[model samples]
Target chain A: MLSIKNIVKQYAQHRALDGVSLEVEKGSIFGLLGPNGAGKTSLIRIINQITAPDQGEVYFNGEKLNPDHISKIGYLPEERGLYKKMTIGEQALYLAQLKGLSRSEAIKRIKYWFEKMDMQTWWDKKVEDLSKGMQQKVQFVATVLHEPELIILDEPFSGFDPVNAEIVTQEILELNRKGTTIIFSTHRMESVEQLCDSIALINRSHKILDGKVKDIKNSYRDNTFHLNYSGAFPAEKAGLFSIVKPADSENVTVKIAAGKTPNDLLSYLLPSIQILELKEQVPSINDIFIQKVTQLS
Target chain B: MNKILLIIQREYLSRVKKKSFLVMTFLVPALIIGMYGLIAFLTVKGGDKKAQVKVIDESGIFAGNFKNNSSVNYITTKESLDAAKKEATESGEGFVLYIPANIESDGKIELFSTKKAGLSAVSNMEKQINDLLRNKQLKDAGIDPATLKEIDPDVNIDSIELSEEGEKDSSAGAAYAIGFAAAILIYISLFIYGAQVMRGVIEEKTSRIVEVVISSVKPFQLMMGKIIGVGLVGLTQFILWIVLSTTLTGAAGKLLLKDKIDQVKTEVSVNEAGKTIEQVNAEGPAAKILNAIQTLNLPYILGCFLVFFLGGYLIYSALFAAIGAAVDNETETQQFMFPITMPLLFTYIMSFSFIVNNPDSTLSFWLSIIPFTSPIAMMVRLPFGVPAWEVALSMVLLIAGFLFTTWLAARIYRVGILMYGKKVSFKELAKWLTYKE
Candidate 1:
């Protein structure tokens, strides 16, 4: 669990984070969604204590975020890398130890993770010998090797192939299932939709929206429905509810007019057209994100 | 603290384990010995071959006056100048030395050769002719030639250094050599290892691993760890080089100069057999050098060297680290590097040309006291025996300078490491210092 309050980060004349506040519930997958340069990285850096907020405080697990909290949190920056000349096993062990693990413990965990990632033979290979995607996998393994209470990953799937990305996604879910909190900042909205229990969308330097994913989606719902019917569509009797789609199509979408429920549109269309499938079209987070960002601009 | 140690260990081990480190450690001493051997060989071999000089003493007073040494041989001829010139030219083996009948008044002599003669050879011939003429003039003036020789006695100055412990022999030349060598070593090491620190920082930044590193520890800690780590590597290599070079050069001396060593040993033994003062003085130079080396306070010099070397390295390497962080790559480093290294370069050159000779001058005193130039300037002064308080003051100032520069560098490094693709100017770097963490 983490709580960030009124975090303001400034860089010379540019403001990286402007009074951004958000709470992440315990054991929840929190998606920090933002466009490029939308201050997501600045906020993430603040949470990880890589840099301090100009005028704010962060609480981790009911305690003030201090250096001791560094051991309890793991961070994978968007621009991640490994020492190209160092062996994978040595590099991983060093990184794990830096996160406050003992040397032997680091080695043991690295061995386990390397085996799990099917990188058993890569222990002695230098990072330069690995492909970019392979290096990303090694970086990912290093990120979670110490088993921190909170894991912050920025664009974690950028260099991973589809299969490896799926594996990593499963791993993230598995880690979360075991009671680890996850905060991922990414531009991948579909992954955010798939994995995040709650989401915070930041625009410019401020948080525009945040809450349970379902609640945010529900709030953005415009009461639109997609109807697939066999009978002739009623074009004239649709005054109470406006048809969002063109009138000639067999499968059409409609929006209920103000002060009217879905039942009103159903009753109006029943006599003329027998509705086979009536599904309320909930706005995807992608659509809501674009709409919200465009509206702010 | 543990994380810092980890970072240091990685930085140190990664470099120390490289093949280049091993090669440099061994190869440097060998190259140095080889270069010295080459010089020694050229001097001895070239000195062994004597030049043949055909002296045509038409005045007949200079016959049998010239002596043959290792580098020149004299062959007197009685023929006319043309005949001597024709014989010498036909043989093409030596030069023709002509003495005119009125040589005493004119004090002029001529030597004809196929090529320009060596200055020492020509001067040797002139000295022989002059000595014969001078003796003849003395005899003409009713004075004994032997008495004239006795009047012109050889003089040698033995410099006795007065110290608190009493008077002892000191070789100013030896002291100068040691001081100059130490200053040169410090200068070279600063560039080699300071640049190593800079390159290490650039490697981390370009690889984008610094962010991941600083997330676990502070940026200042990372910079310090890297600087100290690279410094330890330098010290290790230096210590190994000292041991290995001493051993290697000792073996090489025995192997290459065996005959010379035996000759010196026989000369020393002959002196032990009741030789005259002249013979003893003939062997005094070698013994004087050994005595000078023994009298040098080596432990004290080495101790001061280690302290100043570490202090100077810390200061310069921190600035080098800042330069590394400010730039995107090695080529970009040129702009920032010049200003930082100017004082060091200026002091290093001055230490060789000016400070060593004038170790007690006001310029030397100030240069050795100021932290920016003290490392090299103080080293050049150390062999001449610096006062305790001056050294202490210089050391204290150096430590303060180290801390101050490290603080300045950390400020620049923390912000610069994170900035990507931005052409950071001095103004921009200054602005970064004002940025909130």
Candidate 2:
């Protein structure tokens, strides 16, 4: 488990991160969602020990984070830095050793990762010679080669194409399944919907929403329904439920008032029209994300 | 400690394994040796070319002054001055030395050449005429030339030095060689390793690799690893260069001296005897130099030279590391490096003067003891023996200076490694120096 509590970071006149906090459960994929400059990088830097927060305490596996703790945390900063002149294998081994693996151990791990990623041929190639996607593959291998307890990837999927992104996504899932907690930050909400079990959303340096993905979506749900009926229903006859859009002659999307139940909405609409099919619409994570962020602003 | 060693090992291996480092290491010595050989070859080839001379002795006073050598075919002419000048220019005999009547009174001889007379040929002809005039003056005075020469016995004096520890001193050449070796070692090490640090820092910063490395290791560890690793690489190259150069120089020396080996040995012994005689009759600048050379303590000089060389290199290398971290580019480094390098340059320029005036004075003592200036200044002072305590104290101070400077540099490095965009200034560097974390 990774816990970040009340992290506040101030930079001169600006508060980069203000009272931001979140928890990533064991064997879970946690999404750290925020728009550009919404304190995600500041929080990530603090977690990586690149900088210290003005007021915060981070706990990993029930212990306070320290230099020793850093060895168990794999961090891939969003800027995507690597030594351009160094060969792929050399860089991987160097970073692996820095993360507390011995030389032999690091080499073994790097070989395994290389083979797993089908990048064995790239061992002798310099990073600069590799394409942007290939370099990211090298960096990704370096990050997870040591098998840290937690992996924090800031926009890990940015440079990757869809095929490569799927490959990484599968790897992240496999790692998480094998008991590594992953905290991935990105603006790609679809990835969050696909991979994240829970998410923490920060808007303007504050955590405006956080919880299990299902629970957050459930909490933001307003009783709404979509009906596909052959007969037309008068908008006034729909009672307190307002028709957001009338699709074709056979379909209509409707929103009910706050206190109205699904039965109450059905009771009013059934009398005015022949209901062919009526289904409750559960909001998608993307819709909920956009709504939450916009609401906070 | 293991982690530091790991960092050092990684740095050392990575840099040493580089093709550029290997190329430079071998290339520098080869270039230096090639330059020296080229110069020697050119000198020898230039010296072998011969010139012809035509002499015009108008007074009949210096008629026999000309000598016939294979290189210089000297011809005598008693024709009219205008005719001789015209013949000299037209014939293409290199030059005509016009010796006028009463040349000794005139005190100057005129040489006319088609283009220009070779300087060696002109000087040789002048010396021969001057010797003839001197002999003529001696004969005119009613004194036998041989008798005058016999009476003027060359005075010789033997040099003997008593050491403070009751030991007889050896030749002064050893002292000079030791000082020379020490200064060269210090200069080469500082230059090679300092640039290594600069390049290493620039490489990391330019590639943006420092962002990842900084997350795992503090910038201090990284900087120290680079400095130590590069220093070791420099030492390795130095050792290799010394061995290669020594072997090459010895082989070349043998080849060059092969034909004249026996003649050179006999000539050297005769020269030594002549030097003793000259020392006895010594007057003017030569005698002062001989005295200074005699007073030098060769052993102590050599010892101090080694110590100061190591000390000074470490001190300057630390500063270089700091500069490497502070600047983002090599061009910007020049602005700061000049001030840092000035002390070493000043010490080298003023070295001989310092040795002459007062080798044991307060100025020499302080300059030689300070870490920044010590390598050159101490080597300069070493020839005129410093006290044992002063050497020990200087070593201690130099070590302390290295340690303190390294610590200060590491502090700046920790912050500077990750800093980008804003151009770093002295004022900003001062602020970083005071930053506690």
Candidate 3:
């Protein structure tokens, strides 16, 4: 678990994070959603202790974040990097050791991860010899090899193909299921929607939205219904509900009037129109993200 | 501490294992020995090339007067001077020496050749002619040539240096050579190893692995680790070079110059009559050099060298590391490098031009004491012998300077490594210095 309280970070002539705060619950896939240059990286860096916050405190598992907690946190930066001249296994072992693992322990975990990722043959291959996606896989293995209690992955899926992305997604889910807290920072709203139990959407220098995905979606919802019907839309009863889209070629979209219910509208329409399909439209996290960002800016 | 050690180990091993490191380690000593071999060959054998002289002695008094040595051969001809000149030109083989019948009064001689004779060849011919005329004059004056030889003054000035211990034979030339060599080694190693640290920093930054590495260890730890690591590599190479060069050159010396060394012994004994037995018994130029080196107190000088070597490397490499972190790539490093490397470059030039010549001057004293220039400047003075307190003070200041620069560099490095795609100015770097950890 991680808690960032009133985190304020500033670079020269620019405010990177302005009083942004968030809580990452234990054993949850916490999505940190933000646009480019949205202070997400600044916040993540503060949490990782790569840089200190000018005016805030970060607590990891109820203790103030200190150097000792470094071993308990794994960070995979967006620009996935490995020493090009070093072999995959050598670099991985080095990284694992830097995380406070013993040499034998690091090797054991590295072997396990390399096998899990199907990278056994790549142990001796130099990083430059590997494809970008392959390097990403190696970086991924390195990130989780120490089995940190909390993992911070910045744009973890950027260089991955769909297949690898799915694999990484499954790995993240599996890690979470095994009681590991993950802080996944990305702009990929679909993954956030798919994997995140909770998220904090940051825009510019502020956290614009924070909550469970379903609740946030429900909070933005209106009583709008999408109808697929091949029938005459009764012109006189149109005043009962405002038509968001007119009945054109077997589809009608409308928002029900405040005093009416969906059953009442259906009853009123049953005589004139035979509905093929009627369903309430729930906004995807992608739409809500776009709408919220556009509104805030 | 453990993490820093780990980082140092990784940095050191990664570089030391490189093929370039191995190649340079073995190849440089071979190349240096090869170069010295060429010089020795040229001095011993190239100088022995025979030059044939065609002599047309018109003076009957000078018949069969010229003598031949290893470097020059004289052949008397009965042909006329113009005919000998023509023959020499046509043959294109050697000079034509002509002595006129009025040689006893005018004491003049001439040489004609198709090509210009070497200065040594001309001088050798002059000496032979001068000696022949002198002997003839002495005989005419009724003085014996043996008496003239006995009266010849061959005064040898034995330069014995007086020090606190006692009078010891000293060669200023040898001291100059050793001091200059040590200073140059420090100067070159500082640049070579310091630049390597800078390039390593830039590699980690450009590769974006610095972030990953720093997250586990402090920036200060990482920077110190890299500087120490590269410096170890430099030290290892230096030690290996010393060992290899000495061994190889020693073997080559025995193989190529066995006769040359014996010749030096005989040459030394020939003119060393009035000197002490110690001077004559020193045997040869090689043994004298060995004595000079021994008198220089090599262990003390080497101790100072090791301290300043690491100290200088630590100081300069900290700056280089900071510069590397401040820039995005190697090309961008130039703008930042000039100010940092100025002290090093200035001291290197001054070590050769000023310090070596005036090791005891007030300027040399200050140059050797200041931390920035001391590493090289002190080396220039070390062979001449520096006071103990001055060396101690310089070393302490160097350590202080190293700590200060490393602290300054660490501040910039932590912030700079994460920054990308921005043209970093001096002002920007100053701002980074003010940034929080």
* Candidate 3 lDDT over residue span B1-437, tens digit each: 99889988988999999999999999999999999798778757853777888887777766787766546778888988888887777898788888888898875788888888888679878877778778889999999988998998877766777778888777777788888888889888888999999999999998989888887888889999999889889989989999999999999978888876676556566645533233343344666787887777778888888999899988899999999999998999999989967988898898888988899999999999888899999988987877789999999999999999998999999988899998999998889888878
Ranking by lDDT: 1, 3, 2
Write the number of the candidate with greater TM-score, choosing between 2 and 3: 3
- Which regions in candidate 2 have their CA more than 4 angstroms from the true location? A8-15, A53-55, A203-205, A226-230, A236-240, A243-253, A274-297, B35-96, B104-108, B142-192, B266-364, B434-436
Q: Estimate each model's TM-score.
A: 0.93, 0.84, 0.92
Clashing pairs in 2: none
Residue A176 in candidate 3 has what lDDT?
A: 90
Report i-RMS for every model: 1.1, 2.1, 0.9
| Chain B TM-score list for all models | 0.88, 0.78, 0.87
| TM-score, model 2 to reference | 0.84
Candidate maximizing DockQ: 1
Give the C-alpha miss distance for residue B255 in model 1, angstroms: 2.4
Which regions of candidate 3 are displaced past 4 Å? A235-240, B43-49, B52-70, B73-96, B112-116, B131-159, B263-291
Worst 10 residues of 1 chain B by lDDT: B273-282
The candidate with the higher DockQ, 1 or 2, is: 1
